[model samples]
Target: MGFAGAMVVAMAVDALLGWPSKLFARIGHPVTWLGGLIAAIDAGWNRESDPPALRRAAGIAGALLVIALAVALGWLLQSLLPPSWIGIVLAGILAWPLVALRSLYDHVAAVANPLLGGDITAARAAVSRIVGRDPAALDEAGIARAAIESLAENASDGIVAPVFWGALFGLPGIFGYKAINTLDSMIGHRNERHEAFGWAAARIDDVANFVPARLTGFLFVLLARKRSEALSCMTRDARRHRSPNAGWPEAAMAGALGVRLSGPRIYHGSITDEPWLNGGARDPLAADIGEGLTVYRRAMLLLAGLLAILACA
Candidate 1:
């Protein structure tokens, strides 16, 4: 199918049913099973006393197997159903599990409302629900900063990347992407335990997200009426991130909002003094977090419109 056709199908499904809870749970519920498989594979490889290259190869092979399983499941389900409205229904079902637009807004609102109401304690508690940071010590401004940063980062990871993959290759693409993302969230890390074992998952996620991240940055620029500088922000800040992909959308969001992001912050009691992006912009506020939500929604709209237009063409 053409890109436009795929997008049209994807968007129509998104609008009509949002996400099919049953389908997502049915298709995605097997990570537990897959995780066990990977654990066994890793343990077997560990006992071999192999070279680092061999161990890395085993990890990559395991990751590939997990991806293959998801794709196969999606394909198998797609084949069994009648082809009448199956494409749209299946696409919707797949997309439902993949996107989290409503959930994202609700999560941010949980923090925004409480903070605006002058209940710092309530606000901290709410922010902690979505962010991994320590909420106990955060003041009003700190809470706002954390919420805004989380929203921007999630714009790329949670929203754009999945949508892009779904558009590119339909359910299989989205499923594959989500599997990689899930693996990354679960095990991909730089900490001592995951540094070596989770290397494959992290690296694959980095590669898979590379183009989507850049595309998402462009989408943000277009939505913000600053298309000219969007690419520049993407180019400049793309390298600033250790992950190689997250910086693209973060920088674009920072530039669009005219607020700095990516500076030093404490994670799990340790401080990461990462260089900041958009340092020249305004200090982030709770209001900016609200504005970030607006930008996120607009970007989603632009994507939907693009999909519709592609279908039209």
Candidate 2:
């Protein structure tokens, strides 16, 4: 079986079983393991008083070490299996944890379910798990907006990007990409402790995600009911957001749902006046989050279909 075939099987398994809770309780998720390594590096090396250049160098070294380890682990797994169909199945099993389609949907649903039930506090608490923003201060609209934004961004990072790399370079590629993403999540920020130190990790993540992010936006446009509006928002507003890669799916999502996103918001008690995508659109409601999930589901299905076709070809 080819890499694309393995990807299809892995995605199906993820959609159906979603990292079984029993298994996870016994042996945590891949990201959790990766996080431990990243945290250790940060604690050991990311000193607040270190010179900016030295800190940056240390961060880069740590990121490189993590990437090498991930790749080596992937290679070791693949090497253990005979080069046959069984190897492909084992590869799919190993690759399954790296993709987050089911987990992402579940997390978003956790927020939407509470909001739909009219429990604002529960909604805020659910959204806090997926976002860094201050959740206690959020209203219903704020909670809904945060959930939708996180869904869009993570759909790209947690789903499409992994599939893209897995299809191209098999297990090693996907694991390496996950390492980059994990490093960024742990240390990539503009805060005083991370600004200089995390520069390399942030930039590396941006580069790794560049193509996959755009592909996710294209999938969103295809699935969106308002295709023209989604495309227009992607073209006009994607570059306006802070990150080079995040805005693509976010803009498409904003236009698809006809709800504005990425406006002024509080993060860790600081308010950032970010540019709004689809600025004139309506503020998101609980129903809008449901609509966004519909779009995300369709887009994921479309991606699976495409991968299957390529595998067949």
Candidate 3:
């Protein structure tokens, strides 16, 4: 199947080049394009005046439209390519901007370096770019926990999930998945404006990510030094999270690193009292963020290796 080959090519290209700043400045990235589309749809269709049921129905229609458009565009592009190995390579290159491999590394490393230098100020500033929590309230342990959790969860969201879909149905699959994810990120929340309007987006995102999230957790468990600990923690604590899919990777990372994560934090001026994963373990420090990144790297490499093996077979 072209699934393995196409995803491998996309991952390799993204790792090597990282969608250079110059190129991004000129044309922006594909995800940004998707975001813009989602924003436009949200603004137009999701009316606050509408009843809850009407808003929900509109939201569902909007989501289906975006997904259909993305899949259609993907099919059109894929069809224009030469029907050979070159087509697969080209598809991967086109898919490169969709994968956020290098960006994830750079983002987590930004938090870790400043944190290791004892610059809590700068570390908090860096972490705010990736996490939604109130950065000012975060001390060293809080900062480390937020960054590590973001890294582990995003490892599934930003990388593995896309690759998993790409590996299953090639271009159209990946494109449709991204559409669902972007819609969820844009409007899928419990706030007054989005609670009803974003229900379908959230539910679809959960279903789409269910398998990929567990696979990402499994990859982390396989690469972690404390393999049994990671497995036990994941099996024990994954379902307790607020998000149906995110807990798998976060719990696995917490158990693998022998640290606790996801206790409680401030979001939008209110405290969300989340239960901890690996709650008995010590709090994670800056060094553990680096260790988390190391495991992330190994898991990604292992995924690539498996893809290569499958491609050859």
Candidate 4:
């Protein structure tokens, strides 16, 4: 099937059926099982290699194997169940676990609530729930900036990227994307410990996200009018960020929201001087995070619309 058709099928299934049948709840659902299985494999296979090259190879091999397994298992499920509504219903239910809209909103809401309540301590704690940074020193603005940054960055990684892949290759592509993404999340760090060990996951994720991130920027521009500047900002600033891919969405979001993002952030007690994007606008505010949510919603709708058009065309 074409991209459009696959997306329609996937989204329709997700919207109507949602995730995880009670029947499978005892096993913690298929998505959880797949993630757990990959995590287990990574735990063992990752230890078998330590040199940068070996570790990188192990990570890639592990990612590919997990994807293959997901595909094989999906096929097995297809066969075990008859091709009536049961097969289609089961597929939709299982697929819902792969998407992450509800989870993302919940995480961001946790951070925003504390900020709205004027509790800096609680706000910082909430920020810590979503970010790995030291939150104690962050002021209201800093916390707002961090939460918005994650919302923008993850809109691509956690939401659009998976949907894009899933639309193209159905269960297998989504499964592969999630496997690589999970590996990246776990090991794709720049710290000394993960710099070598996670290099493969990091690089593969970079490539994997390269298109989706840029597309996210484009969709943002298409949705927000005043944010039209996002197109130019994305073109210019995306390449400037440390990660070859992440800056596209961050820069696009910064421009869309008319604020700066990603400059001089602290990680693991040390400070890394990162350049700012869209410095011409106001510092981001709690309200801008709301704007970010609107943008996220538009992007997802645009994604679904694009898929529908593709399916029909």
Candidate 5:
């Protein structure tokens, strides 16, 4: 019953009016709530004193608990709605805060605007909010690359993936995905303490993002001005980047803009010697970030259009 249409509403609302500050001040975001839960579970279950095998098991149990709680809340909310057109609208409104469509665009634009003004200091500050790398080390070219890469990668995780699931499974889908994603972000790292314990969270995140990531890449390819190059680069270079999911969209963006991305970079004082996507291409300029935003908007439109078609069907 208009599942696709509900997603369309969620997209439209979020794009027009992002999560308002007043509302956020009053009630913290769903992710923050989930994050609190994850933190508690991590402190309690992910013990440094525990053996690695038992820590792994505890992580699994903790992950399951978080997922179950989110899924259950979503199910309960969905059950409260009457099954009608009104319910569809309500469903979309509830899912609105989950998608970060406008937030991603605005964040990348924040970098572009300052860089365009030739304020390297301001640009560096803007980009640092979004990327994990050391901003102080970045020149204009580095800032541009970081911002565009963030735009492309988060376009999948922040927008398309949630929309894909929400359209298919309503509240349960979006909520469950956010919970998984948040857990991964918080605990899924190869640090000494979390390497074994966070294994389950990392693996689950990978599996969840697999299809949405490719779909996001395809969307970029379909609408890119340099369509053929985008396709070729995505196919040839996606695997070259570090992440299985992030590389698809990031490579496609690199090809679409005719700019190289994902070469070596410093993260927290250490160099991550990542392979480049479209390595032969020139590095991105500040203006390329603006161009990347245009492409991003187009790809999102194409996604919304497809969902609209399905809704009419």
Candidate 6:
């Protein structure tokens, strides 16, 4: 068994078992641990009084340090483990937490379930856990759109990208990608606190996500009922999104579900007049969220099948 074999097992394990709550309570999460490290770096070096250039340099150093640490750990695991069934199983277990298919589905379902029950308040609260925007301000359609958008974007960031790297560079590759992603999440904001300090992490994350985002879009196109619309969204509207990589999957999802997304969202107290993807499409409903989950499930299955074929080949 090799990288592809290990990834297939890991993905299956994640989809079936996810992370156990008992285990999580005992040990927390790998991403959470990485976030702690990032926070420590910010506390130590990302000072408000520091010059922008110096802050940026410190951020880069911090990101590099984390990446090196993650890669070193991954390499050590691979080198120490013998090439046998035990090694493959150990590798899969280590990689399982990095892939987030089941978690994503569950979180999105939490929002959809409440909306389906006609509980707007619970729906709003559920959506708040996933998005950065003001959930309190969202109407039913807005909440549905936010959940679908998060599902689409995270399908790339949380699932496809990790598998892509794992297939190409084994455990080290996946761990390194996760480290970069965690750094970006912790410090990669456009606000006063992180704008300069997070520049490197943000750029690195963008580059890391570029190819995987497109792949996610393509997966959406395949799973979408309206294939042409999905393709059009990926080629046309994806470019209009604020983040270079996030737009691809969001556009594909919007087109796939035939719903408008990403226009005039409120963050904190300010309104961001963002461009809409699939602007002419219908407003999303709770039913559309269910539909999006169906498409997401199909896409994950397709990805798994593709990886299985690759592993055999």
Score residue 275 of candidate 6 by CA lDDT. Answer: 93
Worst 10 residues of 2 by lDDT: 76-85
| RMSD after CA superposition, every candidate | 3.5, 1.1, 0.8, 3.3, 0.8, 1.0
Candidate 1 residue pairs in backbone clash: 19-96
Better of 2 and 4 by lDDT: 2
* Model 4: lDDT of residue 68: 73
**lDDT value, residue 38 of candidate 3:** 86
Candidate 1 lDDT tens digits, 121-146: 99999999887777887887778877
Assess every candidate by TM-score: 0.84, 0.97, 0.99, 0.85, 0.98, 0.98
lDDT by residue for model 3 over 1-313, one digit each (tens)? 3778889999999999998999999998888898998899889999988899999999999999989999998888888888788998998997888888999999999999999999999999999999999999999999999999999999999999999998888888889889989999998998998899899999999999999999999999999999999999999999988899999999999999999999999998999999999999999999999999999999999999998898888
Clash count for each candidate, listed in order shown: 1, 0, 0, 0, 0, 0
What tens digits encode model 6's per-residue C-alpha lDDT throughout 1-313? Answer: 4787788888999999999999999999999999999999999999999899999999889889989999999998888877987877788788999999999999999999999999999999999999999998999999999999999999999999999998888889899999999999999988899999999999999999999999999999999998898998789999999999999999999999889999999998999999999898888999999999999999999998998888788
Q: After superposition, how far is residue 1 of candidate 6 from its true place, in Å?
A: 5.4
Task: Name the regions of candidate 1 deviating beyond 4 angstroms.
Answer: 1-55, 81-86, 225-232
lDDT of 5 at 75: 91
Worst 10-residue lDDT window, candidate 1: 1-10
Those runs of model 3 whose alpha carbons end farther than 4 Å from true positions after fitting are none
Kindly indicate the candidate among 2 and 5 with the higher lDDT: 5
lDDT of 4 by residue, 1-313 (tens): 3434544555566545545456456657555666687668667876743777887777678766766776676556545655454444455445556666656666787788778878889889888988877898688888888988888788788778887886676566776787778778877777755676677778888888988988888888877655668887888788888888788888888888888888877877889898888766678877777787778778778888887776566
Task: Write down the lDDT that model 1 would get.
Answer: 0.72
Residues 62-121, candidate 2: write the lDDT tens digits.
889999999998877777876777877788888999999899999999999999999998
